[model samples]
Target: MKLIHAINDLTATHKDLLGLSKQKTEALTNNKLDEFQALLLEEQKLIRQLEKQEKKRQEVVEAWNEEQEYSVDSLTITEILQRLDGEEQKMAEDAAITLTDTITELKRQEQLNKALLEESMKFVQLSMELVNPSIKSMNYGAASSDKLSGRSLFDSKA
Candidate 1:
């Protein structure tokens, strides 16, 4: 029963993570640095809370195993579910599946966000290149100064 609740909580937290991922994509797309930073902080807090919940679930499972005189090592959720019966078993299975699906979706959203950030960075780099073209160094005759100067692509190509 407690494991069921823990899985439910895990699913909820990851759903929140998915939402944050989407919001992060929006922030990056719209160039909202302040909102992006704030969302990242909130994302960190939620991740910490999710970790604590996982630990709490682990403690509960260990306590259950100890009371049953079972070895705690190598225990899977299926083993825990086997200990349950009737509606409790169904609830546990549903919660487990939901949690797994939610985590998968969260990962997909995270990947999408990462790609967006990468593309945004590439766009910024290209923009900078257009604004301040890189200098191609070339030595002049001995009478000329040693320093080489930059030229915009348009100017040099023309």
Candidate 2:
């Protein structure tokens, strides 16, 4: 019973995470840095909560195995599915599928968000380079300007 409950909680939390991931993508795409930062905090909280719930779910499985006089040392998903029966079994199966699908969606969204962020960072760096031209330049020349014409004034090995 507790295991089912934990699975349900995990499923719900994952659903929340999936939603947050979508929101994060939107925030990044729209260049809403404030919203994106806020979502990052929310993401951390959900991830921490999910970790706790996952631990609880594993403990519940161990407890159930003990209750049913089964060896808990080598507990696997197949073994757990066989232990569960009736509606509980169906619910657990559905939750597992939902968990997988939602996780996949989250990953896709995260990748897109990462691409957007990388592009934005590249743009920022480009702008900075343009504004501060010397940031990417190397002047390995003599102190006198008269000696500069034949030497390299830029960042190059030539």
Candidate 3:
């Protein structure tokens, strides 16, 4: 059960990371550099937290295994079984609760990131439109005028 919870927590963290990456990509595409930087910082913090949690979980599992190994030789088999069962049950319940909380937090962060990305994109698009009315329709083509003579290539062609 503890293993299940650890896997769930890791999965939730991965989902949050994916959402963050999506937001960052959108922000970059829309030219929201400031917001992107802020998101990146938040992502780094979350990653650190996830790493810490994973390490702690591993330690707990290792400790539990070591206790089980020692108990196997010192205690009757039935007594050891009961103890292990109790510990496993407790671990499962705790893991479930932790995983649920982690998932909820991740979802909240994802929503916030999505909103920020949308706002940034909207702001950039509006700003661009306001700054250059024809920006959306402007096309890049070969220059009609010669750089040195300032003469229209079209005129020479004609």
Candidate 4:
């Protein structure tokens, strides 16, 4: 029961994170830096909550293993499912599957956000370059004798 509760909490937190992931995509797409920053802070909070839930779940699983005379060092969710039966098993299975799907979608959305951010950065860089073009170095190959030296582009007398 405790294990079931923990999984449910974890899944709920992950679903919240997925919702934020979609909002982050929108914020990034619309170039809303403030919203993006706020979303990041909220995501951090949810991640911390998720970690706590996961720890609780692991502890419950370990305790269950100890009671069942099984190894407490490592156990997969599937193994946990095997130990459970009836409604508990069904609920846990469904929650686990939903959590997995949500996490997968979140990852895909995060990747898309990353690419959008990269493109935005590139756009900003190009814009800055256009506004303030860099001065090119005049140094030429040693083998080439043609040299403008320190001469200005236009005669100063003009």
Candidate 5:
């Protein structure tokens, strides 16, 4: 009863997370820094919410285990499914599958976003390098250093 509700809630939260991940991919692709920043904040909130929901789910499962007097130290979803029968079991199994699928999709989206960010960073670095070329180290000899020294002009003037 309560466990099923908790599972459903968690599944819903994960679905929300998956949706946000999709939005993040769009924002990343479009180069919308502001939208991306907002999505990040929203993601943090969802993560916090997810943590609380997970804790609640664990508590409910532990409570169920205690109620049933299951001797097992850890009660996983599969183990819980064994005790459950009929509609509740079916609902829990469905929720688990959906959650797993959503998580997989989220990971894929995150990978795409990561690649986009890396490419954007590379482009920015290239642009900066073009604008201001960095000086290469002159390790051939002291003559190379002397040629680069500003003191030479001062010395010539003096």
Candidate 6:
């Protein structure tokens, strides 16, 4: 359905935007200038994928409309019915396959977007942990040691 296709496209766009925003936010917080640039490039790639899907969807819609408009002009009612039935069946099969493929692709994109979001969140958390002054204070012993050993400040308490 055209409505379904439109909805899917909109959903994909929304997810892509959300993922991109999360990535940008995480990059800023983490002070990872190189990662930030890479994220920007990835966002562009997602935009291009969305555009390509939209174009394919439009083509499907146009083909579907044209198929529906086609008429089988025949002198005999039987011949006309046969032709119409064949055309309808063919169109139905094609539409079904196209719709299924479109939905699958959309679902895959959604999953990818979700994964990207999760990765962004992880990056944000990692950045926060790295930059948080309190964390250093909490591991004061390690910070004080010139060797940068893994021992925590709490090690003495144990």
Alpha-carbon TM-score of each model against the true structure: 0.81, 0.80, 0.43, 0.83, 0.84, 0.37
lDDT of 3 by residue, 1-158 (tens): 45546656776776777678777767766778898899899899879978987786676566665765753323332343355556665666555566667677667767766787687779989999888878336543444223536655466652
Which parts of model 6 are misplaced by more than 4 Å? 2-10, 70-158
Q: Taking the tens digit of each residue's C-alpha lDDT, what string does model 6 give over 116-149?
A: 6687789889899878757445755533686647
Task: List the global CA lDDT of all models.
Answer: 0.85, 0.83, 0.67, 0.85, 0.86, 0.60
lDDT of 1 by residue, 110-147 (tens): 88888988998899999998888765434344434333
Sorted on TM-score, best first, the list reads 5, 4, 1, 2, 3, 6
Better of 1 and 5 by TM-score: 5
Compare candidates 3 and 4 on lDDT and give the better one.
Answer: 4
**Candidate 6 residue 89 C-alpha distance from true site, Å:** 21
Quantify how close model 4 is to the true structure by its C-alpha RMSD in Å. 3.1
Best by TM-score: 5
Once superposed on the true structure, which residue ranges of model 5 sit more than 4 Å away at CA?
A: 137-158
- lDDT by residue for model 4 (1-158), tens: 77778878887898899899999999998889999999999999999999888888888888888888986579899988998889989988988898888889888988998999999999999999888876543445543434545554574665
RMSD of 3: 9.7
- Tell me how many residue pairs clash in candidate 5: 0
Error of 5 at 61 (Å): 0.4
TM value for model 2:
0.80
Per-residue lDDT for 8 in model 5?
A: 81
Which of 1 and 4 is ahead in TM-score? 4
The total of clashing pairs for model 3 equals: 0
Question: On residues 1-158, what C-alpha lDDT tens digit does candidate 2 reach at each position?
Answer: 78768878988998898899889888887889899899999999999999999999988888888889976696876678887899988877787777778778778878888888899999999999888888237554355556765655684684
> How close is each model in CA RMSD to the real structure?
5.8, 6.2, 9.7, 3.1, 3.3, 13.2
> How far out, in Å, is residue 110 in model 4?
0.9
Which number leads on lDDT?
5
